[model samples]
Target: MPTFNVKLPMILSLLLIFLALYVLALRGHFSYVAMRAGNYRFSKIESFNSLALNPLMSFSFALRDYQKDTLDLKPANMERLEELSKIFPLFSTTPKNDFALKNPPHIMVNLMESFGTQMLSLQEGNLNLLGELAQHFEEDFVWTRFLPCQNGTASSFFCLFFQSPIVLSKSKYKEHYLPFIPIEVYKQQGYRVIFLTAGNSTWSDLGFFMKAQGADEIIDEVALLQDYPNSSKIHFHSHYGVGDEFMYQKALELLSSAKEPLLILTLSVSNHPPYPEVPILFSKEQIPLEIFDKIPKNTSAILNTYVYANNEFARFLSKVKQSELKDKLIIAATGDHRVRGVAMDFNTEKALAYGVPFYLYVPKAYQGEIVYDKTRIGSHKDIFPTLYALTLSETRFLHLGGRNLLETQENDKFAFGFNAEVWIDNEGIYPRSSNLGYKYKDNQSLLSTEESFALDEEHLEFHKIYQEFLELQLRYKLLNLAQ
Candidate 1:
């Protein structure tokens, strides 16, 4: 009996140890699958970087059919990837980069829970980066604005025409906006839409999604890559997307010729890295060319390229403004998320890094001076509705989780911030301790209350919605789902 008792504990412990090892091995096999799980675990928490290390994307060369659709699996060697799977679960994206810009880098980080500007909690001050970037890109047109919510890019695009917040499956209650389709409105209002990217139409399956959202045309790299292969191999570099400037310049040509009152959302492929170095266009230097030349060709090149692109794009935009096309152009822009795995140089904090920047530039609405509150805040999802308010468009939105960028918001708070997610704003850092909770002020913070029951309830609903959205994303065959 005594021996059995002693052995029991040892046996039980051994069993547990064996079970743990087994589970770990299983996780090793399906680490990427686990990442898509959306649960709260150490794996889920730190997996953001690992995911960034390798972004699995579906990109196609323009007009190059017959080539099987391939996922851009970075850290490409399977054996090495398997080895990495043991050490650190990493994600791989297609492409890489090396380049820099004298003008400040027009960098955008599209992290789910990462925020920039150093602060960890949500506050007005944190989101000021968008406006700051806008100012940096300032030239002949207006630059600088703000919005609300980091909800997916879905609502961010639509809310551009209204003052409402567009919600994503990942958005908070007061934050989510109605997911109203706006293409009909734009078309009815006499606007031609073109959603451009460097991937096959089926990747985002954007042909259907954009048409549903009011896009009239789709210009992907598959169509434009052949136009400029010899021009420059340099790409701005983002983890996902193609490393093609042909698409960017091609889109520019199309926009340049557009009549007027045009709404364009140009999704570029260079800034996020996993890209080839592209050449700079500007003749002048705002930042420093040496920095550009020294960038690691792997991904840092995009850092340099993004800024240069931003500078040149800003210049191009200025010329676009000057063109006979139209005078009432308002560009609503923001990063989808943050850089995937910025560990060393930049502030890639889970909270800060997950947070991307946004701002508005309306040449017609140039009456307002550059509003750098250093105290105001907002998110990606809120962009669409925020802009809609300016245009006074009749389009209604649903499922958005952001608010107007131009107005003073009361109780500006967020709930259910996902992994490494930031909960901050300009007033100060509003921290949330749980997936669901009231806005966390500096004192108690939602971050601190994350373990609370209320937060759990929030998480439950949020997760439920997320799961439903995931199912829909899969069912609908949506590629990125925008969140």
Candidate 2:
């Protein structure tokens, strides 16, 4: 019997060897193995291979125990914090003026899914993508040069909420109480923070994270269905949950009955993929044949969802404007990241790939002498700083990173932006993985990389300091969590 089981033992031995190699590759001990392993996605695999690889994914989390040894970095972190404080001040005191309201306005941040400028740039006379939202964009403040902190939805959401770029994988935010959390800041100022989403909050443990970050209420797909039984369901993309209109309708309901100042963060999922069936309210646009041929195969499906999302948002705004909350609300909307299906040459079109629109609609009552510069380059980090400046008065909030885009001068040295893969400033966009950066003009459409366009010493120094600052901020958070 033992001799007959030789093949079983051989297979077990090979499986053990493969697992060992996978662990090594995940740790990046072998360059070739690491390169190959980096491309592995368990979602794409449809066999026993996913099960085998699943356990190994937790290997990265195991390394977090080693990172707890960063207590020694405290002094260095303190020095960096001091240096950064001088550059980016923590407290934002609202100016004493007539524009300052007697009470803080309700802050509404709508995170539209895949609302990229690259696709919007394709909107010509015949090809209308914006739909009803076009009129609002022309009237309100829309910044085209803005980028998201990360390319993925979850990463960008966390980046904006925490006001930091360092997002730990599989880490429970409940364990770590970061000082830079925007929800906590809003809570401290007596504002009720509500996180509304059209998708399941349990998708990335986002519900738990939002609760830990001081969100007063979380309205997800389950909550929406419980409240409104007749709400629309996502027929095609059931995983994405209800349509955008239902989620926005819930927000309007909350605003109508709110007693306290509110900070409602709405995440719309209708614009995601595999695209949901277009709602009845969506008006289909005619895409030009010339531009149609250049896009991905599912361009029609993508545009339908995009235009639907825009129409829903515009409808939401119109309702808000008609309500009594019109003069008492501050709405800021932006995309989580660029649309995924569009192809871009990374060597030249990196900015276009990362570019998303930042649309701000400040109430006339709250509009001080603030200069609105649509050409300024920024990312998700700057969103809260601008919001804090407008909403809070003389409140001391932690400035983890980013400047107040409204008050920051054009020549401000700290006016640079750091997306996940690139560093953006007045000069151009610099990809972190590459030595050479590209120079652009007219809102990053035209690119040039001449011999004189190399990253200078000053740029290198800024990058070095910024990278270290991010690491220190993360280390400090970990140290706080350990305590």
Candidate 3:
């Protein structure tokens, strides 16, 4: 190749322009990702603008006030909401019955082992992707934000499936379906549903809650390993026992026997932890235990396992292409939650503890690829509702608590709270406060009042509605709320 003459001035000009643009983009990215969230808006636009510059401080302040919101609840409502929030895992509501259905448009994700970092890995030219890029997804799948439920894998899994937040804070291996999840409502409309965790059904007390919410059939490691007697491989890890991968292969088989439009979920355990003796991708020998042992205490093991899980996601994505159900499968791949012990040092301006990443990938229908946007505000709570909105028709789904991810707005607005965080982008609001801007896409003024009383009142009402949602969920046992 012949070298072209390069002018010093031209090179300098290009460099300057590139530098400027990069700086601008970085500023925008950081700003959007760092917005403050809590029970109350900022004292003033000036306060928010000043602190918002430092996202870490803003998020800390926000978290500090989470207890404040609960405290602010009227004694009666607080008691009512608390009672409704506890007991069954089905934790929320909106009064509507028999929501419409799109037949098999319901979704199920089989997390055959995943790590939070994989979603952030694109540095190696898609070499780490589980599946080849969905051509349409490459251009259109714009990432909106992070979802809140990243503490555990199961939390992220069920949260998105139900289109609402899964109450992991209650410290049980189980959670319930809130009425806000369109998928549960679809089941009310006569759709078939089943959740299969290839590990212990008791993983996280999920077995009890999964049933409370009305999963017709539930199978844990015992069933696959000895109880029901199906072919499965044994895997023994502190966190995940045998039959993790077995669940994947068997879930696929179940799909083969399923009627049209059925929703079947199969989760994995190998990537969960204590990963021992799994084969390396290219190495001939098995992964030596020493490598894992040599990791620097907690971080080293988590990192190694996370890397292994990332590769698994890439493998799963790639494997789907080679299968028959590619078209019918709308896989919502994401982390249940970032392993907090591993992410102990992580902090963000917009809810630092919420490092869980939720990515909704529909093989053929996905309009773009690389759904991760480093600067968007998102949470685990956003996963389920968005997943439902994406799979089913938008009109029917629009009413749900979670917004359609395809419509990720630009205003940097997220509905974030203890177990809930939802964002909608692309809207204009006066620089000062959160208006009704969130209640509806166009109704910015609906919430725009300088009055603290109305803010308090509306907030309480919203809280009440959310409580009612969970209460209804418990009553109906929708989305496995039975426990």
Candidate 4:
């Protein structure tokens, strides 16, 4: 008993316990671990154990698995590529000329932050979330059954430009020059590609990434401040920088002095979280009592910013419509993701949770026989393909996986969100987490999920094809990175 040294053993045991808890907490914070198991405690524990054993060991195991999968799927990748090439032709030298415009219309893509359809669809008699943007939804072509490429702002933005999901560890932007990027295609067609954002471009390496992808100019918050010294900053969460109104003003100025065919991509920031107080001209009394009850405690602030973003966008659209650029511009706008902080059951409301409106305004000159089918399912990936077909002539660009939404073919009318873990079609919505699918009815004003049901074979087949397409894209990306 004297030689046992119980105190030393107790201290060592305590230290070991502390170290174990520390490791668990540390592992829990890792993005990769959190991404895999954010909700489930058991899954998180497993992830922690795997990480604590050896952090690099997981990577090693993943690498081995990837290698094995690559070897087995190499032939399948080629086959898939060939099949996809036939579906989405690699070279479209002949412009669709449906609009028969005198000149190639200037392309303007507006990426609205947190403009979630869940909140937008809540617009009833008095509860108006869109504000000034409501009329445009009626006048322009908007696809209600739409999903974004991913849920997060940065990922959605990257996917919209790259036509593929962002690879977290080694992004294509970091590894190699992507040949099939829309910006590069626009550049090759003699269009000056400019990216404008009210937020800091360096936040997610956005400016660098855009420049790498062949954007001629990246006008971010720094440039915005320099250009418009009088512009007011949203100091509450200052990373978002100036308001959307100022950014739109800058865009207007650029449009006036354009020397060549221009493609301007504007990313708005006012609708984002930590919703700061902006000039709220709209009345809060418009919100219906029932709808107001559903939102978070900061409903007033969130709605104010939401309306502010829409009002600024509407003002920009009105100005463009009144100006000479109206006839020369092809405007496309969509939300980066659904508005966060909304409480909903994912099992029942996956479509509503991830839904975003895809609004398009093609100049009258280019509006050939385009049928604005509101029921067609689409995402950000389809935006460029539709634009390329409209504006480019005989340009050869790689079509990773997006279908031209303008195409009348019903075969490819399906929306899939790889990062959002959801797939939707005319039949039903299939979330990756469950075997049962949810049926959603798209109405004139709102899209409401009805009941949980089983997916038909056709829907299941489409989902399978989508999964294969994503896999092929990932494999292709990994191989490119390895090279």
The prediction achieving the highest TM-score against the true structure is 2
lDDT of each: 0.38, 0.71, 0.44, 0.69
TM-scores of the candidates are: 0.50, 0.79, 0.53, 0.76
Question: Which TM-score value belongs to model 4?
Answer: 0.76
Reference-based TM-score, model 1: 0.50
Compare candidates 1 and 4 on TM-score and give the better one: 4
Clashes of 1: 119
| Rank by lDDT (best first) | 2, 4, 3, 1
- Model 4 gets an lDDT of 0.69
Write one digit per residue (lDDT tens) for candidate 3, span 1-483. Answer: 999899999999999999998665434323112222311121223354354345555456546545444411111334553454443223323222122233344356654355343233322442233332333235323242443442456555555554433343223223434443444655754656677765665444555566666767776655555533433332333335553445555565666567755566666666555554454342313334443332334444444445555554445555655676665666665555544433222111122233344445465543222233434444444555555544543334322234334443432323432234322232211111233322222231111122222234534344345535543443343323333
Residue 371 Cα positional deviation in candidate 1, in Å, after optimal superposition: 7.3
304 in model 4: Cα distance from truth in Å? 0.7
The lowest-lDDT stretch of 10 consecutive residues in candidate 3 is 31-40
Q: Write the per-residue lDDT of candidate 2 for residues 108-196, one digit (tens) a residue.
A: 99888999877887777756788889988998888778878788888888777765455543353344566657887778878899999
Report the lDDT of model 3 for residue 156. Answer: 55
Identify the leading candidate in terms of lDDT. Answer: 2
Give the per-residue lDDT of model 1 (tens digit) for 206-282.
33345444566765543554455443233332234345345546655775655544555555545543444555432
Off by over 4 Å in 4: 1-102, 167-175, 233-237, 281-286, 345-348, 408-419, 442-450, 456-458, 461-468, 474-483
Q: What is the lDDT of residue 323 in candidate 2?
A: 86
